[model samples]
Target: MKKLLLFLLTCLLAIHLAFPQPPAIRYQVAEPRLADSLDISHYAKKRGLRAGAMVFGLNMGVWTFDRFILKGDYAYINMHTIKENIKHGFVWDNDAFETNMFMHPYHGNLYYNSARSNGYNYWQSGLFALGGSLMWEVFMENEHPSANDVIATPIGGMALGEVTYRVSDLILDDRKGGWSRFGLEFAAFVVSPMRGLTRIINGDAWKRRSTSGKQFGVPNVSVDISMGIRTLELKDEILDQGMGIATEIKVAYGDRFDTEETKPYDYFSINANLNFQASQPVLGQLNIIGRLSARNLVDKPKHYLSLGLYQHFDYYDSDTISVSSAKTPYKFCTPASFGGGFIYQYKGLKNWDINAFAHLNAILLGGSLSDYYKVDKRIYNLASGYSTKMGADFIFKKEVFAISARYDVYHMFTWKGYSGEIDWRKIEPKTLNAQGDRSRAILHAVGLRADIRLRNRLYLTGTFMNYTRNTKYRYFSDVFSNSSEGRLMLTYKF
Candidate 1:
């Protein structure tokens, strides 16, 4: 249920970016800030105090629910608990991976959006996330402050919050009224509840006007949704998982090659794959890459090239599969990363188009399924390393037929682990502070995809991918595994 909600939240981040109103415009202006000539009547005046208050109120509301409704032990906080938490400082927490990795970030989004919707810029709003997380750790819970939560919450929140905030802004149109206006407002509300509440409180929800609500100039946008079947094979000798439902959503927000925007996420692309009963993770993978800065190298009639800095958020999760003798869950993620990359585009005779890119990033934080680390339902090792990715796409007759290839490789090194001399039976449970398996892992994937247009805005697509993982541990024998996956889907583009 939680995964489903998160998937929907991610979808909402792009739903409004696809609004088809203004014609696509290139970001010729190098400055990241919106031009002063753009209309500001739709947005409220900056209100820093109000934004702070809203963030605090949001935290209080969540604590109220956790304290009274669900009545969890952690919710039992008092003045004494606050002092204890302060004294303990910070420690690695044993909460479930989903809670630390996904939920905390979502909560921080509320904090960030509170400031963003009230007219705060991206960097300024990030402070709200950091402050809000600190308050939650020190005041809202009886447990000690978490080391991982502090790192993941604010950073992850800023990335995700900006995406949703941008989408909501595009959805809000003060020019329309009646049911149309109500629907637009509702959709924006769904995307960012804090922003929606601010709108209602500020009386912008029903206020009609002649000016469009867009703050930033609209850029070219493409949204693709696909649905079909997927198959997965865990091991070469094991039987493949039977066919199951698979759906994908991809959104490209701007003309990357043409954009001169220096702001983060101004030119970005996000892709999400969801599987249902396909012997795969319900939320299989979510990959996001947002441009931070870019410089065009060559811009000719038939050839274009650019180099850019990007921020990345990648996630992969799967349940444990026990087939005969195999019993291992699949998980790998890099929630925060930054990198540099180059993009090349070529237009040729006979209506042919080709695009390619290669990127290398330093992973600030990463996670992988662990073989030896298991503390209170946590079995994933946290590490920091780097990754390299490259891909290319070919389009013929303006998308009548298309094919793409991609390759990704990741190298991670875990920093926290127990000594080999320690006996498993003698080790105390939950006593160690994130003493995970000391190891280094290398994971890689190669994929191929083909699409055939059946008609306008519709296509049939097929994909095949192979994944491999190799891990070397200090205390145990090395582990190696690989999997193969295939998918066939019908897609619609908007």
Candidate 2:
């Protein structure tokens, strides 16, 4: 495993160093016919294959990295600067320095000869820029945030501004910052690290490098309290933009774990989970998500349209829980999942936003260190339920400190990759008592998220989530299972 990880990181580095193209390398893009002897088909095939690999690797890594990066740069602005500076300014940002000649963000494509050289419609450039900027947030975690939800991350909160500009171009019929562009940009940002990790970590295996200690909640308020200590080590930077170096060994500790008792325990159990992302132009977006949930532990969800870069709501993002009595030995620790999908956001609205993204949660292989981790049968088929969510994110910012909120309804989708109900009991026909197992899951959820500033670095956030499921099966005996869980959280920026 260690060797594979090391190799992947190295390959990611090479791809980013070579291709470095942005705007999702439009498949529709007509590559000007080269006068040289190189076959365009061969070149395209190789590029696409490598791009897909790197995209997958970085996405998997970000699946775990995105969780801890919620500490917005604004969190620092509130801490280092005076309350009045923040109060008067309202919004916190490291605006373009005097040296910024291009109208783009710092990490944006500055090459005058690149595809963007011709200039982009709003949605085209907007998505890529926002996606890149958000990816930069990975290394900027100075505090803590939620582990399960990506939008809860500070990077997510602030990315709204960048995404806004991208969205504006679309509603106006300007494809400049279109969703496609945002997706491509996000991919560029992602590939940089995965490739670099290949050059950084000396081993081929992946591990959950740390745990979480942050505790936060806000049950009765417009916004839940988001508070914790999230951390990541800068490991590598293979991208020319000086952004792919992740030398810090991405790690986290003390990310709290919580369970919603309203129904059967619905929560994430964080056991110091860790993962990596390759940042090559073609390799950077690939991600590898690690162990269970609860803390802003695993990486946060990535943006829409950027497939292969693990998403905030990826299907396999969580550990699989069993409904049988035999007790799968791996239940205590969080389960790790591997899957991929994409996100697409619509433009044409000021604060009214809509996003559509999907992912597949393959199989959950979760367990503790000592008792689990066997060779061969190491993975448990918690394929009980799969989740798909559709929602809209709205933004309302007017100098008083930007405010944004998103609400999503998650549908529990099962049958695909489902292991069926755990019938721990095997009965004989002569026993006169046979009970086959059955399972049914509603897998529906409603989530609401918000962020506000009482002043400066002193910010507040709230999140409310509810998940419910009902399962029933028949045999010699009838079995019915129903569970509902809700999490309310609050945080105060230091």
TM-scores for the candidates: 0.88, 0.28
In model 2, what is the error at residue 76, expressed in angstroms?
52
Q: Model 1: runs farther than 4 Å from truth?
A: 1-38, 41-44, 234-241, 278-280, 348-350, 423-430
* Model 1 lDDT, residue 398, Cα: 56
Residues 341-440 of candidate 1: C-alpha lDDT, one tens digit per residue = 9888887666777788889999887777787777777888888899998887776855577767788898998887877787767755545666368999
Q: For model 2, give the 10-residue run with minimal summed lDDT.
A: 17-26
Indicate the residue-level lDDT of 387 in model 1. 97
Model 2 steric clash total: 123
| Cα lDDT, model 2, residue 486 | 16
| Best TM-score among the predictions, by candidate number | 1
Candidate 2, residue 253: how far the Cα is off, in Å: 18
Q: Across residues 293-345, which tens digit of lDDT does each residue of candidate 2 receive? A: 22222232332243332212121112212222222211111122334434454
